[model samples]
Target: MVRRMFLPFYSKDRGPPRIRMQVMGTKGRRFYKIVAANQRDPRDGKHMEVLGSYVPIPGSSASSVAELRLRFSRVKFWLAANASMSLSISRLLGSAGLIPLPPPLFGWRCRGRYHELLQQQQQQHLLRESELRNFFKLPSPISTQLVERETEKPKKEDVRKIVR
Candidate 1:
């Protein structure tokens, strides 16, 4: 039997896209990832707006760029919409003569990511370590004794007759 519908619980939304970015960075290094939000929502009309975006050009090599002059006006458009660049992205932009290098954002945001990653790593490590400890306790482990080798005299017959 179908349950009675509640208008408050089921509301259809026809609106703009929801998008955001997930960035990983340290004081001097930053990596960025873009994610589209609300795409999975049934009420979403189309692909959601980007939460964040990044310029993925490898920062180390300038010669890799094919053109001597290029425009990143599209990326700038996203920036104008309040999108932020990853540290690596900022560095790349600076190297490409786009924008000035940004200072380290070492407030709660930077620390918060570090703290979350650290906690996750610690939990994973503990889980693996416990699994290993449990696995070693299984049956069929053979015991062995440790002892030093005893010296033995060489037999004359076994030695070389030439004496060289």
Candidate 2:
């Protein structure tokens, strides 16, 4: 008699697969592998395939840069295959212009290229404000407010009211 081993087959009912990060490396120093995995699988568990890698924290040297290496073609393929992404993975891909950014979460600080873009926008806003003020011949609000404050003295009644 001959015996053969059979592998379990995954079915559609298990839900769509996910493209997410699989944590690796030692304590206090960690790296991630971007992978395609089943949605129901535990984090850092078995994965279908690795798409890329990410190094969030680089070495202590000033010249060191955070690294994020991805195979864009493979990533696109998995996305087209209906793979969802974890929140952090989605943010990373969004920064690369792979897809629209996910909705902002409370208390999340913008970093990297996103922060630079925000700074550029703020500078543009200030420039536009100055241009509008100049075109309208409006008095500088700071100077006018200072002059008004120096000219007006708080009455004794106001002080008394506050003291009461």
Candidate 3:
């Protein structure tokens, strides 16, 4: 069985080139590649496999417009193996009806990506809260002032009065 690997901060530091569809070639020529590689590897480094190819600029007149040289079967296999495509690739495939539009990053994988995103969001929220606290000299979120009076324990005398 193929093990599912989760590299935390892989997308953050190295970016999503490996698991993503990349646009290659110089200015005059451009092509797309669906590949899977290690995050730390170079752009042209070792890849698991070349799932498919998309030639956006087919310079040759002999070739039909928008020629897509793809291994349709391999595409499905890679996707099943937990590989994800870039936004552009998703859009391209969506247009071709191969895959759905607005494809998600880290599709159908475990909660690793989601947890990372949540941590990032939480950090940002904490940072914003700290900034607000510093500016306003307000107490921490867990402070007494922030606690609801209704939820607080009633004093013994108050409880006795209620009982009476």
Superposed by TM-score, candidate 3 places the C-alpha of residue 40 at a distance from the truth, in angstroms, of 3.0
Question: Candidate 1 clash total?
Answer: 4
- Global CA lDDT of candidate 1, please? 0.46
- Candidate 1 vs. true structure, TM-score: 0.25
Q: What would the per-residue lDDT of candidate 3 be over residues 52-132, giving only the tens digit for each residue? A: 777764566422337666677876665665555556656666656577555336672365667765675577667777878
Residue-level lDDT of model 2, residues 14-110, one tens digit each, is: 5557899998999878889999888777888888889999887655742233888899998987777767787888878876668876766444344
Residue 157 error for model 2, in Å? Answer: 42
Q: Which ranges in model 1 have alpha carbons more than 4 Å from their true place?
A: 1-71, 103-164
Number of residue pairs clashing in candidate 3, backbone atoms closer than 3 angstroms, sequence gap of 3 or more or interchain: 0
TM-score per candidate, chains pooled: 0.25, 0.54, 0.42
TM-score of 3: 0.42
Off by over 4 Å in 3: 1-18, 22-26, 58-65, 103-164
Error of 1 at 47 (Å): 8.7
- Top-TM-score candidate index: 2
- In candidate 2, stretches whose alpha carbon ends up further than 4 angstroms from where it belongs are 1-14, 58-65, 106-117, 120-164
Among the numbered candidates, top lDDT falls to: 2
Q: For residue 154, what is the lDDT in candidate 3?
A: 80
